[model samples]
Target: MPLLFLLRLQHIPLPVRVALSEEVRLVSVLVATGLIEADFAPVRPTGPDAASRIATVKRITEEGLAEIAKMSDAPKFAKTSMRFARGLRLM
Candidate 1:
């Protein structure tokens, strides 16, 4: 699910993705393996709204897709497979 989401959605914020079911663990694993970088610090909001804080968070690396292709458990659906194939093109 996380893999598919990542494939379809570009520039997704890390906090928002973690709110998805079971994605926190998946994202953590991906981050640990250098597939994703979570070093982004969201822009601090002047207002007290929590939503604004969440909206500012983001994390990514240039090689995110390529790293996903190297994973053994990459998603198998056609769309995801096609993306993975493309990701592997430069390898």
Candidate 2:
């Protein structure tokens, strides 16, 4: 769902969307590893309010990171993945 939304965001090209998706997945992993809290709530963009929409996602992501940082266990989260060949093809 989030990936689809990322794909549709106008200012963000396909590569950027892919990067953001990977970041989100890493965020999810951190949450799963007890390193942060995940925002399970969905973000629905109504119109052309790009700034607000981007801010919404960024805020939630930052907050989740903060929550994880406060945890004593602070597990090492995995990094985001990339498909270099696929990205090259897209380019």
> What TM-score would each prediction reach against the true structure?
0.38, 0.27
Worst 10 residues of 1 by lDDT: 49-58
Pairs in clash, predicted candidate 1: none
Q: Which residues of candidate 1, in runs, are more than 4 Å off?
A: 11-17, 39-57, 68-91
Error of 2 at 38 (Å): 2.5
Predicted structure with the largest lDDT when compared to the true one: 1
Q: What TM-score quantifies how close candidate 2 is to the native fold?
A: 0.27
Model 2 score (lDDT):
0.38
What is the C-alpha local distance difference test score of candidate 1? 0.49
Cα lDDT tens digits, model 1, 1-91, are: 5565455435553545343325544555556666565432344556553322122114545677675565435445666879878887553
Per-residue C-alpha lDDT of model 2 across residues 1-91, encoded as one tens digit per residue: 3323332332333223222445556545544555433354345655563222122133234544454344423332221124443455542
lDDT accuracy of residue 32 in candidate 2: 55
**Each prediction's whole-model lDDT (CA):** 0.49, 0.38
Q: After superposition, how far is residue 82 of candidate 1 from its true place, in Å?
A: 15
